[model samples]
Target: MSEEPPRRRTIRDVAKAAGVSISTASNALNGIGRTNPETREKVRRIAEQIGFRPNALARSLLTKRSHSIGIITNDTYGRLTLPMTAGVSEALVDHGVSAFLCATNNDPRLAQLHLEALLDKQVDGIIFTATRADLTPPIDLTRLAIPVVYAFAIGPPTAPTFIPDDAQGARLAVQHLLDRGYRRILHITGLEDYLAAQLRAETYRDLAGAELDVLFGEWTEEWGHEAVRLVMERGGDLPEAIFCGSDEIARGVIDALRDRGLKVPEDVAVVGFDNWRVIATQTRPPLTTIDMELKELGRRAGLAMLDLTRGLPVEPGITRLPCSLVVRRSCGA
Candidate 1:
């Protein structure tokens, strides 16, 4: 058995209560037609007192714009996109814009469907994001009438793509070890094909020196352990420090070192990329890692899209925000 819904409050009721015509009530509630400030405030106060709720469809029809935006992503794991989405949402909420997320899960067809549905709903804008900064979104956003922004993922050539500066992030890590007076640095990182890995590795070589070795493997804890094994099999003293591509790998590095009766920071200082706090903070001595600031990237992306919708001047093309080091105990000072 379904229960009956409560009677909805309307403008006519609000007008009667405020002693004004229905037309005047609508104008005051909508902030249009230059209504007298005192009268407008009185109408609004009465409207609130009676719990009056304006119709969204009616408001949109009058405003010619929807106050909602869509977020489309294929980040199967929320690790990267969640914080990014939070940032964008925070920025949009202040501007009276609401965001709804549509997860594509790497399915191209589903992504297209989501995009179409958002368009049908008359969303003011859309944001495309993903787990990888370099991977293109599964959907093609060609010639869409509404404003769109890319964050934590790559988009079209001319699209405003916001991502962390991976090269700088890598440089910051390697330089941290160097500044701590460690010259014999070792680099262990994720797959070679990932742009993030490539950029970080390239910068590591530049800052850690070309002669120092870099071990490329999966972005996993097992790979970190294996990397340590390989280093030991070479039959030499371990490097003064190791710079890993991710916090997961860093944890494995720390664990493997412990198994070999080695002390972190005391035996070998270790640093990692991605301040993934779940793993980073849980590490034995905690992890000193680079933060990509995905939220800040998302915030910027949100603001940029709003500016675009308003026909404001927004710089086009890719925008790489800076990543900073989140200090922890693993690196000793």
Candidate 2:
């Protein structure tokens, strides 16, 4: 007996069952062009009954739209990029798009390699996060005919981007402290080379408009502890409030301050950023901070990148999202 042709239910099979033309069945399945509503419904019902799944590979070969995007991040699994990438992935799912994730580890060679791989995968677009915006990635991505967007950080000049309003977040934190009747406030933040840290520092200085003392270091808890030590070593001139760049740093500040016989909110107030649960809730007294809305940042970036891929006019510049101060026991706000 002749072997039955491999039982692949094609669009023709669906159209035959639904009593519709092949083109009409295609239109209904792909949601392309226009088709009669009743006929479309009938075609879909018939297609479902026959277990007809559209061949995405064949469809992509025809239309050249892979319905996928690549996300290249500085870190792989944890850190700030995790939430942001998750948000972007969530948004992509809503839009019927897939995400291909790649970790660059903030290395130029690796980032370039990953970029090439994503390009080869024919991703509709790309979203890249880098360690330093000014580091000048050497990836020559101009050959790829796809849109690229940056999220939570800026990439090369050839892409549109979105980043949290760090300066605004800092301003919100400092303003809250000042409004709470705290004059001697200390700023504990990351290195000045980082754009986010620099912006926060500048905004604090601008808002304070005075010779304010700032303690700058990396984003680690060690820096936070060191800031407190420096303050204690300087004697009774300790600030009435401390503004930290991240929740990790804030946790360190809390430990150091408590160990040195100072009462939070009673002797000094503290404010942090990122609004992470581990640092905000896990501490002895819950920490107050500015919520940067990381997930929303990723979602917006995904939408913007899709727009770019469609040859639609995207606002070719930085898009800033709103941030807010989350009041907790830390700042006594």
Candidate 3:
């Protein structure tokens, strides 16, 4: 006689084995509906023993939750994600939620494509990191079925957002310089149109007043070098100190200052932002700067998503995280 095909195990099989009704078995397995604790455990154990794996697609049809979160950004996805992405991913995993990340390469079309893909995948929520001020969001972010949170910067159409308080960050750096008794401060920052760059420069101007000598340029070590050159070219009337928008710029400033036969701190105190660990402490005489806490920012974004999923309310509008000053040998502390 030909061997009979094996019978597929279903909720009926589990229910019979656990001495429960089919409805009770299904409820126990899905954690829906009410069932006695003992019966629920018994049904679950029977299903496990029978090697029964519920179809997730079918389950999703019954329950709208897909238990996934998507993150979309514009720019060098790798460089920008950095510590921020790791923080957000880690937090989501801890809650048994999966995360999807996509980069737009600063292209609006690519950004829109990624956004649509994530939406079609039925992600529970989305986090968008805007590239620039003019960039518009693909969806009516406020009308999406999923919750959306904006990070690092804002795009067109307001939504829940979080961004580094560059003004506060610069304030922290400037306060550090002042606390060390450095007046006549010079600032080397990124392009003036950049929100972060503009904020940092403005904050320094507000606090430093006439003492502030601002230099505009790209966020590169090259700019830092030229800033010092500008100081020297000003007929040897150098500022008492320097504040750089980035650690790279700070590095250039340090090189140029040393080349001019000047001593850091002892000659011109220097401070920068973005407490880039590799670039900061690794230097001969470590540099002082403001820490942006990008990773913490990512983690906060993840937590905000979680709150939204659970129907918890967050403070409406943009939220700013505090920045801390990291003192090193560069600034006379």
Candidate 4:
């Protein structure tokens, strides 16, 4: 009762339409083997017009490259991994490559299994990603034969890694307040042990100097609310501004300020880190925060893996990308 779909176009069809030998067409399509530049362009144009897509399996067999990559992540919450994966996919798809994502959720056995499965699938390379920028895998990453890269994840010192510039992000938040003429600023952040927290606090201290009043606590709204109370009880001078380590913390701080009959940006300005839209955009006055540029990091990481697979040299070391400040009403600017 239903008509079948017409036949799918193939490389053979593309070759005939392009008026070239099959081998020549293949070379042109792949941009390899000394195909004439003009001919390559012509063939690509024809292929596009004709909607001719290459058979990945056959092409892989001929080129000895799987044309697929693997992403191994431990961020079960999808907060970081999802956006990064989206960026990675964008880069791969443009080059006609496919990617597979394996979520390990911090389970060691699952991580190992996914690693081995990716190897078995003959992925061109692997990218390790996680929620935490400082996450160091328990596995020995140095031994893998294929190209390995870390995106917001840690690997061996010699490996290529991409992470946000945490200290720089901190500076942006604190300086935004100072630029708004709030000289006395307080810093309230996550656990002291977290590398992100440590970097932010260190930068806050550097810029705030004598005006710095730092509070290290859990990365929770409860801690944020309590820190304000602690400051009040200590009889310390209330800060002109508060720089929060997270959007969640900023929300708590804003609420606490409201309870104390203070108006945000009028009585005190607040700046938050991790422009996580869910929390940042919902605050009473909205939040001015730092964006980690995580999606861009993923794109860079994907391209880096592609470079390694093609025998291009990638300088090995941690590449710290800059973070950007997002301004909103909360910062009074």
Candidate 5:
């Protein structure tokens, strides 16, 4: 038979080894009860030498805090949820908290099940995330007892939501093109129904005025290529720069421009949004784009959840964080 695993060392063992009462040992190890520096050090040393480890469950029971939070996402592809989850995990781990992740695949029933299970586990709080920035939670958030925060998605009117500032991102991209002396700039983007698309297009109009061309279509490379072909066929004064809605679209625009014997950033400059690494970096002249700062958004949501759990007041409603411009060869930056 395998030798019975050595019994795990306990506070009682440490107390005996340090020649102190159990209460004193507990106080010293936890830095409670105002133990003197010398006594605390001695108790800690004994505990360390004996490999004494506190029972987290027992400690949590006494403190009434599980030190854990649950994160729920309906993003089947993890395009947005992954980075946000990473940020939340990093922030929570710094505070000695653990995270539990559940992907609901956009199914309301599955989301409800996950939420109920997390509540049953007594998580301190919950964070709801999604693939789209403007998505609303499938389940009613107001009914939950624990605090809930929204990231890359919206909740009810009273819920706290975090999202990237799309208008500001648009402004940044346009301003960069303007700064580079590209007066004849064109906007090619995805479906107008999306809040992100609408916001970006509005910002472009606000800054560049009505005359600048705006094309609305799907968020695919095919749409990008088709739009470019249509523009070239129209045969007016060509745009000095093209601002695409996404990296994939930008890649299509660049390829189409190359096929027409136009040199990027010399005959025409180009920019894209989403900063999606694989597409952005691989473009002939790597695409300049706008970064949504999804990780920071997640970190902020994690901190907000912690604040709410601690009974700290936080402003409800959407908090829009600014997006940054990522410069690359596409825009001659």
Candidate 6:
């Protein structure tokens, strides 16, 4: 009752139709060895008409290049990993290379398993990513035979690692507030253990000195709300502006300020980091924040990995990419 579909066209069919050898057809289609212009055009036209596609496996075997790279991450929430992976994939696709993504869920065994699997598939390189900028996955990345690049992940001291410029991002946030004439600016951020939090706090202190305050706490809306309340209860002059370490914290700060009958950017300006869309855009007046440029970091890492795979020189050690300021209603811009 069922009829089978016609078989797919092969290179041989194109060669037969063009009255040329299969090798000649392949060379013409792939732009390999030189062939006369007329014959090359004829072979390609016939191959196109026959819908003949080269077998990727056979091509790889002939060229000794898989044209595939592996991406390993432990980002269960996909907050950071998703953008980085997108950048890496986009860059690789442009060069006719593909990517394989594997999530380790922060498990060492799972990471090793994924590594082995990718290697078994003969990927040209590997990109290791992390949820936190300063975190290093448990995998021994240096031991791999293939090229490896770290994206938003800490690696060995000598490894090629790419991450956001947290210090510069902090400087940008503080500078923007200063430019807006917000003299009494307060900085509220995540835990002290986080390098990003520390860097932002240090930058704030350097710029504001005794004129402002830096509050370190959890990276949560609750912490932001409580910090505002605590500052108010102290009975000193309220900050004319607040720079939050994250959009989530900024949201809480904005809500708490609203509760106290303060209008954002009129009575007090606010700025947040991580221009995370959901939290940043949904804030009362929207948030002016620092964009970490995670996607760009990923793209650069992908390109770097490709370079390494091609035996090109890539500088080792950490590479810090710049962040940008995203102005919005919250900052009166």
> CA lDDT, every prediction?
0.90, 0.82, 0.80, 0.88, 0.89, 0.89
Pitting candidate 1 against candidate 4, the one with the higher lDDT is 1
In candidate 4, what residue range of length 10 has the lowest lDDT sum?
132-141
Instruction: Show where candidate 1 strays beyond 4 Å.
Output: 1-6, 16-21, 36-46
Residue 182 error, candidate 5, Å: 0.2
Q: Report the C-alpha lDDT of model 2 over 1-333, residue by residue, as the tens digit.
A: 898877989999999998888999998877676888888888889898999988989777766788899988776555667778788887778666889888877677998888888878889998876544444444655456778787876655556778888888999999999998888888899887888888888898887655557778988888888888887887777788889998989989998988888888888899999899877998768999999888888889888877877789887777779888899998774
Task: Give the worst 10-residue stretch by lDDT in candidate 5.
Answer: 132-141
Supply the global lDDT for candidate 3: 0.80
Off by over 4 Å in 5: 1-6, 14-21, 24-53
Q: Which ten residues in a row have the lowest lDDT in candidate 1?
A: 133-142
Task: Give TM-scores for every candidate, taking all chains together and pairing residue i with residue i.
Answer: 0.92, 0.90, 0.82, 0.94, 0.90, 0.92
lDDT of 5 by residue, 117-193 (tens): 98888999999998777776777777888898999887776778999999999999999999998888899999888
Which tens-of-lDDT digit does each residue in 23-55 have in candidate 3?
A: 888898887897878878888888999977776
lDDT of 5: 0.89
lDDT of 6 by residue, 153-271 (tens): 87787678999989999999999999988889999999888888988888889987767668889889999899899989988898889999999899999999999999998999999
* Stretches of candidate 3 exceeding 4 Å from the true structure: 1-31, 34-55, 131-143, 155-158
Ordered list by lDDT, greatest first: 1, 6, 5, 4, 2, 3
Clash number for model 4?
0
Clashing pairs in 1: none
Off by over 4 Å in 6: 1-4, 16-20, 28-50
Question: Which candidate number has the best lDDT?
Answer: 1
TM-score result, candidate 4? 0.94
Alpha-carbon shift of residue 307 in model 5 (angstroms) = 1.2
What's the true lDDT of residue 45 in model 6?
85
